[model samples]
Target: MAEVTYYTEEGLAKLREELQYLKTEGRTKIANAIAEARDKGDLSENAEYDAAKEAQGLHEAKIAKLETVLSTARIIDESNLDTSKVLALSIVKIKNVKNGAVMTYQLVSETEADFKSGKISVKSPIAQGLLGLKVGDIATVSVPAGEMNLEILEISR
Candidate 1:
């Protein structure tokens, strides 16, 4: 069974757009490549044809994976989320317990996570530790670098 993932409206829209592109323009481009490769020479000795077939297989696998994801995706309403504690789609402001350095992150699904844009995956160590925490609550997160303490400063939808 596929695990259901929650996505914001914008994230789901982006995913659908990508799937549509892959089904249309993406498939067309791959089909053209295969056709061109097949016209080159005998199938037995054609490396180009072999490569194109491999690429097509990979592309089809990607489409299948995306379709599965779409089938199990659930759109989350950000406006209805509780601001009292950290949760998925919550924009959380945290302060490092040791150095007092403040940072903000929006907890989102893996597909929507962009570290540079302050969006972190909900499965990440930091976000996992922050989950269910309220403002002023200190969470100890174990990261690859080591263990660190962070205090939840604010939570917003």
Candidate 2:
């Protein structure tokens, strides 16, 4: 069974839009490429045809994977989330215990995680450690660089 992933309404809409594009314009482009390559020469010795076929296979695979993801996707209601502790979609402000560096991040699904936007994946080590922590709670996170301690300063929906 595929694990159900929770996404914000915006995230889910983005996924659906991508799927629609892949099914329509994306597929049409791939078909055109294949047709153009086929028209060039004999299939047996045509590298362009081979490459086009390979690209089509990969594109189809992506579409299949995305379909599976959508099948198990669920939109999370931000307003109903408990703000007492850290959870998915929670905007959290934390301070690094050693350096006193302050940072804020929102825990989101993998598809919606964008470091530039201060959104981190729930599966990330830092986010995993922060889960279930409340305001003023300390979290010890094990990261690729080393172990670090962080204090949760605030949590919000």
Which predicted model would earn the best TM-score?
Answer: 2
lDDT accuracy of residue 30 in candidate 2: 95
For model 2, what is the error of residue 77's alpha carbon versus the real structure, in angstroms, after optimal superposition? 1.2
Error of 1 at 90 (Å): 0.2
Candidate 1 has its poorest 10 consecutive residues by lDDT at: 75-84
lDDT of 2 by residue, 12-116 (tens): 999999999999999999999999999998899999999999999999999999999999999998888999999999999999999999999999999999999
Report the alpha-carbon TM-score of model 1 versus the true structure. 0.98
Q: After superposition, how far is residue 14 of candidate 2 from its true place, in Å?
A: 0.5
| Model 1 CA deviation exceeding 4 Å by range | none
Runs off by more than 4 Å, candidate 2: none
Candidate 1 lDDT tens digits, 21-56: 999999999999999999998999999999999999
User: Per-model C-alpha lDDT, please?
Assistant: 0.95, 0.96
> What's model 2's overall lDDT?
0.96
